[model samples]
Target: MTVTDVIDRVSFMDFEPATASFRDDVLAGLSHPIRRIPCKYLYDAAGAALFERICELPEYYPTRTELAMLQRLGPEIAALAGPEAQVVEFGTGDGRKSRLLLNALDRPASYVSIDISRDQLIREAAALALDMPQIEVMAVCGDYTQQTLSLPTVGRRRVGFFPGSTIGNLTPVAATAFLARCANMLPGGAMLVGVDIPKDIAVLEAAYNDSAGVTAAFSLNLLARINRELGGTFDLSGFRHYAYFNEDQSKIEIFLISQREQRAAVAGRFFHFRAGERIHIEDSYKLAPATFQNMARAAGFEPTQVWVDPDGLFSLHWLLAPL
Candidate 1:
C-alpha cells in the first residue's frame, strides 16, 4: 500500500470554500424553471468510482476512443515528448491512462498529478510509484481550476499531459482561463491536449445517455452525494436521468428530471420542483476543430499537430508555445 515516494509526498488539504457555496447554488438552481447541478461536484470518491464504471460501458465513446488513440500513437507522442521531462497531468484519475504516455517517455524525471479528490490521487500515486520506481510521483490534492500546484523545481522541460478530453467540461471562457493557468505553471515547452471533436447531435446524445443506465446512475449520484455530504434528503427514486444534445449550443446536457412533484430543504432553503421539471446536472460541450484551435490561441498556445480518429469522432490537439 506504500508508494515509492510516500515519504516525499504530502497529504492534500481541501480549500474549496466554494464547494459548499456551489452546493447551495446548485440547490437554488434546481428550484428554478430548469434544474441542474454542476457535474464537477459529482466526483466525491464514490462518484469518481461510478464515473470509472461509466467509462468502461460500451456506449461511452470518449474514454475508449481517447484510450485507443493514445495506445495507437503513444510511442510517437512519447518520442516527441523526449526524456528528462517533468510530466504534469490535470485531473489525474486512475492514472492508468497516463502511464500510457509516461511509459512511452522512457522514464521522465518525475510525474506530478493534480486532482481535486485527495484519496484517489494518493492511492493512484502510491500504486504508480510502486510500478514505476524510476519516476518521482508527486500528488497534489486541489481543484486544478484554481490551486497553487507544486512541482519539481528542476527538469529539462515541463510537458503538460491533459488527456481524457476533460477540458470539454469547461465553458469556453473557463477553458481559456484554465489553459492559461496550466501554461503559467508549466515552463515554456508544449502541452499535449486531448479534445473531443464535434459530431452529430444524435451520436453525441447517445454517448451520454447510454442504454446500460450507467450514465443515468452517474448523473443521479450527485443527489446521493449531497445526502452524504450536506445532510440533504433526496429520494433517488423521485428523479429520472435525462440527457439530450443541444444542437445550437453543440453540448450534451444531462439533467435529473423530477418523476413527480417534490419538495426538499437544503441548508435552511426550501426548494420545489414540478413534475418533469429537470435539474441540469452536467454539460459536455462538443468542440468544433476550428473553435478549439481558436481557444488554444487565446490561451497562448498554437496548434502544432492534431491526431484525429479514423471515424473522426474525436481529436487530440497538440498545442505548443509560440516558437
Candidate 2:
C-alpha cells in the first residue's frame, strides 16, 4: 500500500528521527514522585483520533469558537498574510484551520504542513493539495517543538498558522521560546495564532469534563499507549480520567487517577500508584490577550490585529515579524 502517493502533485516526507526520548521521558517521568507524561505522547494514532472527536464535543468551545473567528476574519487574515505567501502550520491535524487560511489567501505560492503523525500529515496534506491545485503542498512529519525544523524552498513571504490553541499545551516560558523560534524561522513572515482566553471556571471545567467523556478517553489513551508500546501492564480499568480548572494557574489540568492502590510495570520496572493518587498528564493554559501579546513581542513579533469571538471565549491574533 502506498502510504503517501503523490496523487495530485503533493509531496510527502516521513521523518522519524533516531531518538529514544519517548522511552527515556516515560521512564524519567514515572520515576518522579509525582508521575507525569509529556503531552506530546497523547497523540499516538488512537489518541489523535480521540482528539478529533473531542473537538466536536458540545462542551469544547475552543475548536468551534476558533473556527467561527477564522471564518469571520478570512478576508482580514488573508490580507494580513499578504500575497504570494507560504503557510506553515504546526500540528496539522485534520487541516481545518489550514483550509480556512488557504482558501482565503490570495495567490499563496505554497503550503507546508508540519506534524509529528505521518498518517495525519499525509492524509490531510494530500487532500488539501488535491483540493487546492494551484499551491505547492509540502507535508512534513516530524517534531516541530524541538527546534530542528528545516523548510524547503517555498514562497517568499511565510505566514505561520498555529490554530486550536495548541500553544496552550506549553508553559508560558516555553510558549515564548516557541514563538521566538517561529519568528526566527520565518524572518520576514507573519503568523495567526489561536489563544484561548480565561473564562468562567464552570465553563472551563465542563469543556474538559465533557458529558460524552471523549476528553477522558483521550487522556487515558496515554496509558493505553504505554501498555502497547512500552511493555507496560497497566490495568486500564484501575484508573479514571480526571480534569479540573486550576483557578490560580488559569489552566486546565488533566490527570489519571488510580482508583485504588496498584502497581504497574513499564519496561521491566514496576511503578506504584497510591489509592486516589494522580498522575499529571497535561495542562492547557488559557492566556489573556495582553499576556499573549507580551509573549509575541518578546518573541520579536508585533501584534497587528486581534480578533475576539462574540462571547470573548477565544481570540485569533495576527503577529508580524521583521524582515
Candidate 3:
C-alpha cells in the first residue's frame, strides 16, 4: 500500500473526463429554475486550499470545535479501538485529525484514509507513513461515498473514524443510509463521528459567510474549477457568493448568486442565469444531539457516548454496531 500505488489506483480510474462531465452537469443545473449541485466537488486543489483558510477563520466553529473534542477525548476513543485495530477514515482531509488518534493509540497496525481528492489524500497519508514507519498506509483515492473501502482483513478489530461535522452534508435519509453502510462495513464495532450542534442563525450564518470572505472565495472557486476542467466559459465576476440559514430546512444553504443576467457554456451545454437567482452549492445540516442519535439508531448503531465541546458548538460521538 505504497503512496505510488495509490496514485496508480486512481490513475487507472480515469478521473479527468468524469470530473469534466460532472462540471458540465453542475453548470447546466445552475441555469435551471431550481439550481443546485452537491457542493462536494468544490474541493479541488485550489478549493481545498481556500477551505483550509476558511477553517482558520474565527467564525468557523466546526473545525476548531472538532479538533478540540478530539484533543480532549481522543485518548478515550483510542482506548476503545483495540491496539491492533486498523483505522480507516472517510474524507481524511490532510489526515490532521487522524494523527491525534494515532498519537494516543498504543499502535494502530495500519491506517486507511479515503478521500475524493487523490493528491491531497496521498500526500498527507505518505507523510504520516514516513513519520510512523511501523503503520502501513493505504490511500484509497476515490469518492468516500462511492468507494468500496478494502480494510485490512487481517486486523483483530476494524474501527472507522469519520470526524468532522461532515455527516451534516447529508439529508436525514441519506445520513441514516450512510451510517448503515458504515455499520455493515465494520460489523460489530465502533465508529467515531463528529457532528455539529444546531445553533442560532447568527452563529451558523457567520460560520458560512465569514466576514473575511474566505468562505465566499471557497464557494466561488468551484466555478474556477469548472472553467479549468470542463472547458467552461463562466465569468467568475458574474456570480456572488451567498450563505444563509434556510429556516424551513434547518440547514445552512450555500450558493453562488448570479450577480448579473449572464450566459455561460460548458461541455457543449449553454446556461442562462437571471440576476439574483441563487445556484445552491451546498447544505450544512446541523443536528441536535438527540436527532443525530436517533438517526444513528435507525442505521443500526447505538450512540454509546457523546463528547461535547465547552461551548456546546459541536460533539463527537462513539457509536457501536448492534451486538
Candidate 4:
C-alpha cells in the first residue's frame, strides 16, 4: 500500500432510480384540488444548494440553534453511544454537524451515510472518507425511510444520527411510524435526533418566508424539477411562495400559490389551478420534549436524555432501542 492509498475503506452501496417516481407523484398530486408533494423530493442539486443558503439566513433559527446545541453536547452524546458504535445518518449528508459528532465519537466502528439522492450521498461520503481516512465510510444512496441499511458486520452497537429537525417534516401518524421504523433498524441501539421545540408563530413564520426571497426561490425550484424531469410546463412566473405557522396543528406550512389561473401540462396531463389556489410543498411540526418523548415511546424506544440550548427553541435527544 502506497502513501497515496487512501479512501480504499470507503464503500458506496447506491440506489439508482429506475422508474418515474416524480412523474407518478406529479400526476397523483396535481389531480387534486390542492396539490401536494412530499418534502423529500425538494433536494435536487439546485434545491439542495438553495437549502444550504436557507440555513444561513438570519430568520432561519433551527439550523444554527441545533448546531450550537450539538457543539456543547456532541461529546456527551458520544459518551452515551459507548465505544465503537456505528453512526448511521438519514437523508442528505451534512458536513458541519457530521464533523462535530464524528470528532466526538471514540473510534466508531464505521460511518454509514444514507440519502435518496445518489449524487449527493456518494459525493459527500467520498469527501468525508478522503478527509478522515481512519474511519470506515459506507455510503448507501437510497431512501433511508424505506431501505434496510446494510452496514459492516464488524460493528455490534449502532447509533442513529438524525439531526436538522428532519423528523418535524412528518405528520403525527407518519412520525410515529417512521420512528418505529428507525427503532426497528437499531434493535438494542441508540439514536441522537434533533427536534425543533414549539415557539411563537411569528418566529416560525419568518424562518420559512425570509426577507431575501431565498426561501421563495427554493420553493419554486420544485416546480422547475418537475418541468425538467417529468416534462412539465409549469410557468414559474405564475406561482409565488407562501409560508405560515398553523397554530392549531403546531406546524409550518409551505406552499406555492398560483398567481393567476393557469393550466399546465406534466407528463401529457394538463391541470388547471385557480388564481389563488396553493400547492402544498411541506408540513413541519415543532416537537416539545414531552411530545417527542411520547412519540418515541410509541415507536418502541425509551427516551434516555434530552439537551436544549439556553433559549429552548431546539432540542437534541438521546433514545435507546429496546434491548
Q: lDDT (CA) for every model shown?
A: 0.78, 0.87, 0.79, 0.83
In candidate 3, position 301 carries an lDDT of 94
lDDT of 1 by residue, 191-283 (tens): 898888888777787888888888888878888877777667789999989888877887877788889988876665667778987787777
The C-alpha stretches of model 1 lying farther than 4 A from their native spots are: 2-34
Error of 1 at 148 (Å): 3.8
Lowest lDDT block of 10, candidate 4: 1-10
lDDT by residue for model 2 over 1-323, one digit each (tens)? 25636644677766643336777888899899988988988887888899899999999999998888888898888778888898989988988988988888889999989887666778788888778988999888777888356777587799999999999999999899999999987878889999999999999999999999899899889989889888889999999999998888889999999999999998889999999999999999999999899999999999878888989999889998888
Best-first order by lDDT: 2, 4, 3, 1
| Each prediction's TM-score versus the true structure | 0.92, 0.96, 0.93, 0.95
| Clash totals, every prediction | 4, 0, 0, 0
Q: Which ten residues in a row have the lowest lDDT in candidate 2?
A: 1-10
- Predicted model with the maximum TM-score: 2
lDDT score for candidate 4 against the true structure: 0.83
Which ten residues in a row are the worst by lDDT in model 1? Answer: 8-17
lDDT of 1: 0.78
For model 2, the superposed segments whose C-alpha errors exceed 4 Å read 4-8, 17-19
lDDT per residue (tens digit) for residues 232-282 in model 3:
798999999988898888898888999988888877688888899788888
Error of 2 at 266 (Å): 1.1
Strongest candidate by lDDT: 2
